[model samples]
Target: MNEPMDMEAVLERLKEKGLRLTPQRVEVITLLYQLSHPTAEQVYSLMSKKFPYVSQTTVYSTLKMLKDLGLVNELTYGDRSSHFELTQEEHAHFNCKSCGEIYDVDVKDAHQLQYMLHAEQGYQVDFVRLEFYGTCPACAAGGKSEADAGRTKQ
Candidate 1:
């Protein structure tokens, strides 16, 4: 899943999972593969432009199905709506505190930590999802929003 999947690859995955294919579902999978990280609403919005009668339920259900099948991962940060991305190699995520942008961060140290815990504590390693919060370069270099203007370092 690290590599971007073509339409046939996506369809084959759905078929392997015993899921029926429909035009709307195919569109949803296409968006999931194309968009960097999208919420259910964003998927619905884009699909609506093409399929005017598509329902939010359809979008949510499809996302749920993808997640259940392990083809996609859902990232939940605080109270915000979860974001979806194709399943990929383990990596960390950075959340820009000011603008709420999420970026993928390659962290070799994460693997080292997992190895250490497994070797020393006899704990089995599953998966790692580390979230770091900070101001992105754009927001930190004197590009603060009006609301952020009132905040200060303690």
Candidate 2:
């Protein structure tokens, strides 16, 4: 993972976009900054604990505004719920099937791929998202144990 973002810088950027600094917006951005990629519901649940007055609609609208302002990125893994994360240096995502943990993966040749696509296909790619799905280390090891136990039973 890359270094944590400076909240002050993010706030300054938001100001430059002519967005007023509200408590709910600050809470949502802070949570996004801390947690890599969290669903809108996840963000609402966390914020509701401290700021119970904030509603889900407020969170959703705030996220949409932030995305439009280029402060946050909306991500999906073909799941029922969409996820949100603070925009950082472009990278890929790894979804663990067992643990349900989302991890960030840096793609070194992303620019090269973009260039090739534009040159060969005459395509203009503004952004790219790559996702890999698999069992993580803990889940893989646990699955092996289960398989071994099933063999013993047989």
* Model 2: colliding residue pairs: none
Which parts of model 1 have CA positions greater than 4 angstroms off?
A: 1-7, 141-154
Estimate candidate 1's alpha-carbon lDDT, on a 0 to 1 scale.
0.79
lDDT of 2: 0.77
Q: What are the per-residue Cα lDDT tens digits for candidate 1 across 1-154?
A: 1454566876898999888999999999888766766778878988999999999999999999988887889998769779887777888887777866666678779889899899999999888788889987768896756344212111
Strongest candidate by lDDT: 1
Measured with C-alpha atoms, the lDDT of residue 83 in candidate 1 is 87
Output the lDDT of residue 65, model 2. 92
Error of 1 at 99 (Å): 1.7
User: Where is model 1 poorest over a 10-residue stretch in terms of lDDT?
Assistant: 145-154
The 10-residue segment with the lowest total lDDT in model 2: 145-154
TM-scores, all candidates, are 0.81, 0.81
Q: Which stretches of candidate 2 lie over 4 Å from their true place?
A: 1-5, 142-154
